[model samples]
Target: MKVKNIVRTVAAVAAGAMLIPLAACGGGTAADSGKTKITFLSWDNEQTMSPFIEEFEKENPDISIDFSYAPPTAEYIQTLQTRLVGNQAPDVFIITSENKNDLIDNGYVLDMTGKSYTEKLSQANKDFVSRDGKVYGQSISSWAAGIAYNKELLKQVGYDTVPSTWDEFLDLCKKLQDNGVSPYIEAIGDGADRIPDSFTGAILADKGIDVTTLASKDPQTPGANEKEAVKAWMKVYDEGYASRDNVGVSGDDAKTQFVNGQVAMYCTGAWDFSTFEQAGFDWGFAQIPALDKNHEQYAQGSPSPGLAIYSKLDGDKLKAAEKFLDFMVSDWSLEQRSKNGDAITVDGFESDVTEQYKDVYENNLKTGKYFLMTNFYSNPDVLISTNNAEVQQLVQGSITADQWAENIDAKMASAQ
Candidate 1:
């Protein structure tokens, strides 16, 4: 999953303390074990990754994984950066949007350009971790976030599904509120707002605009495209269909509200399906509505972080790392990942994501009808941080949409 979706509460431990005796990979320091010990710094927690590690070790008896954990987004990046600088980088670790540029540009990650393991990856997954046609990481799954609505709640307003267009969506929100239901809740307090990003994708695609141009270090007009999208998205706040109080809500809080049946629709992804199932509520997931009839629907999404090997590795260590990556996309591993609710994007592999996620998985992830600001933008962390602050102000009625867009442009310019 992307940085925006991961929890940031885990403290990142120092890699120095966790490095095995075989930290210097080409050396035979662990010869006593008679197995190639591969050090892996995992972005996913131990609970989720242990099963895969166990299975891989059981199958490949000649290899051993010396595993360590660092939670995603900021902490993991910082920890990995420190380790790389100290010449103590793990043999394998996650390479995500937040650090792919640094890892590839600095020659810290191995290039898998013609690797057979990458042959199964979809184009979108390959592109996510590639630079200049050279692939660096092996990403297997992708995720899409869209409108998740309470089925029974929508029926109360005489609707069975979310509207297909933005205007109609707002009208439905109004009707839901009129019927004494909390219309919508999305966390605008953290990162970029999903709805406006989806709108931006639809608008850019409709106009045949390539997002990479706008995402460059020096765009001709920094926020020109986003202005229209932000304006369109502000209608939800301007019409009072959704509460400005959402500026303080978090993804967890929004999910809690949705589970309690306090809100009719919640903007999220399939990650919460297990919880929703336990909540005992009928729900449906749909692509975020289009900007208008002329535009197609889009969602906010990207490939999950992928496994990248340390570039300096060679000999036995390198072979072991490659074997681990190959095993990750093996049929057995893919099945485990699918069962864990990942929308597996490896070609020829089918994922059994929950029913509520099928529409989003098929129409959004499979079709590449999704966008993420971080995936496209240069200095992505700056853009997301600025966007979170700016959007909260926009919804709180402190800044007009024009001003909000200008502020983001100014921030992007200053950051460059």
Candidate 2:
């Protein structure tokens, strides 16, 4: 899911909550025209969701969707939470890794078990949003976070492609640095942990640990096996492959640096093609590097956010909600979403992804390593805030790599 999209149209790593007076939030009755009105709260800006909503309404005249108001993740969580506790939540809303636990544990989301639309859903999507083996959220699409390389810049260092292993990667970075080129940069100011996190998950996965299980657990927990992952990540900075000053850069700045040829590599996802393609230089993507020659690359991901219903919805309103979700995964909706740049989830959903991304997708096909590591952590703040802060410290040499790992382990333990 997008933590990748914050730089683009905002990709979805399926990830959100507050209390208010009943009517103040969304306490509307059915429409007088005999249409069942369902309120939808989304993390997507209204402009992004408008066309999809319009199309859904056009198809199902019996249901009307009300997007009273919705903001991005940080704020939407607070606003939606107040409404949920006040019994005024929108009828249809999003369930992400951050909010999945509270929503499912408190019975806020409807149980979607055995729904026909879910039959062909990917196990990755199902596992991300489910609790106790029952599905709750309808994850529609996905994207991956990886390294984007400047093909021309790397060519100056005599490399045709990004290296597959970390030790080799350091050599490449050194060659570029010696050539007066900054080897890599990522917007660490805004949750830039995805690159390191994805690579770490790959290392752990090759060790036979399913990172999804450890996602909600602290990495430094006794026997957790996350230490090696953190050590490898710290090496990229510790060994001078990337800059410590990157702590001040934002995602946009990283993109701009790459465009200006100020940097030879960038850590981000596929969403930035619109900007990158405009660059004067030739570029391509690389699977995230692994720990050594033995490990396979892994990228962080989750099913894109899908339609979810409030548990209390019933009768015609319930039917409408289910129908809307059904329609979302229908061939038409999947095709439309895929056309608009989403890497959709439904099996056999053909995507309009470009030749460049075809390589990225194919790299992970055999391993199915779309790692949803941080999202599996129940407290959204851990990935959104804490992990970033700790990673910054690791980069700036304020904390040892082990200390950073310990910080996250403690955070996860506290979350539990």
Best by TM-score: 1
Which regions in candidate 2 have their CA more than 4 angstroms from the true location?
Answer: 4-32, 207-212, 215-225, 365-368, 414-416
lDDT of 2 by residue, 131-243 (tens): 66788888867777667888989999899988888788889999999999889887877667565556666666666764345544444352134556667777778778788
- Give the distance in Å from residue 341's predicted Cα in candidate 2 to where it truly belongs: 2.2
- What digit string (tens of lDDT, one per residue) describes model 1 on residues 1-416? 33354332224454443433322222244542788889898878778888888898889878888877765666778788888999989899999887887897799999998898888898778878887778999999898888989999999989999999999999999999999998998887654378877887778788886654554446534466678888898898889888899888987888999999999998887777778989888988888998899888888788888999999999999999999999999999999998876789888887987777788888888876777766766667777677778888888999998998789888888877
* Candidate 1 residue-wise lDDT at 246: 89
- What TM-score goes with each of the models? 0.87, 0.85
Q: Which ten residues in a row have the lowest lDDT in candidate 2?
A: 8-17
